[model samples]
Target: MALNIKQTAVAGTMESSDVMVTVKPAEGQGLVIHLQSNVLTTFGDQIRATVQEVFSDFGIRDAEVFLVDKGAIDCVIRARVQAAICRASGEGFNWKGEDK
Candidate 1:
């Protein structure tokens, strides 16, 4: 299994990045993360690492993550990833441009 994400950059405010993850129907445990980062010091790297951390719990080894980053802090990165993961898992949160 491999963890891969087909990411795309959207043309708009990069203040807060968004992820649109879709897991393959056949897969059992997978991680799909779409992450973005603003022009900050190691922010992108931090977001990626944080996302991976979240997936680590599920032992996710397959996924396609997309990221659209806005100017956000590390905490925001973690929160967004968690939110997406929650939504993906049917935990039922909200991703309609709302707060985490």
Candidate 2:
């Protein structure tokens, strides 16, 4: 199925070990990300890249991503993004799995 985000959705928390990802629908355009973080000067590019990669992996071409980070690592970033996408798109994370 061509999974797609239907409306605005949010995932993750604003705690120390998490991040908040807000995704909203967009037209025929690419992903536009607005990142807010304490380490923007240090890890900004990496964070944006990771988010973009995850979105690409899920075949997401159009959306607006607003990420409020709280010192989350790459893995956490991936998880949060995936969760937000699933919540927004209403698709589960069993697309590329072997078993439950």
Worst 10 residues of 2 by lDDT: 91-100
Q: For model 2, how does the per-residue alpha-carbon lDDT over 1-100 read when each residue is reduced to its tens digit?
A: 4569898999999998688999988878679999999788999999999999988888889999999999999999998998899899998886555243
Which segments of candidate 2 are over 4 A away from where they belong?
A: 95-100
Report the C-alpha displacement of residue 1, candidate 2, in angstroms.
Answer: 4.9
Model 2 residue-pair collision total: 0
Please list the residue runs of candidate 1 whose C-alpha ends up more than 4 Å from where it truly belongs after superposition: 1-36, 92-100
lDDT (tens digit, per residue) of candidate 1 on 1-100: 2223223212233443433333322254455555544553566667677767755644456555565666655666556555555544544434563443
Strongest candidate by TM-score: 2
**Reference-based lDDT, residue 29, model 2:** 69
- Please state the error at residue 55 of candidate 2 in Å: 0.5
What's each prediction's TM-score?
Answer: 0.52, 0.91
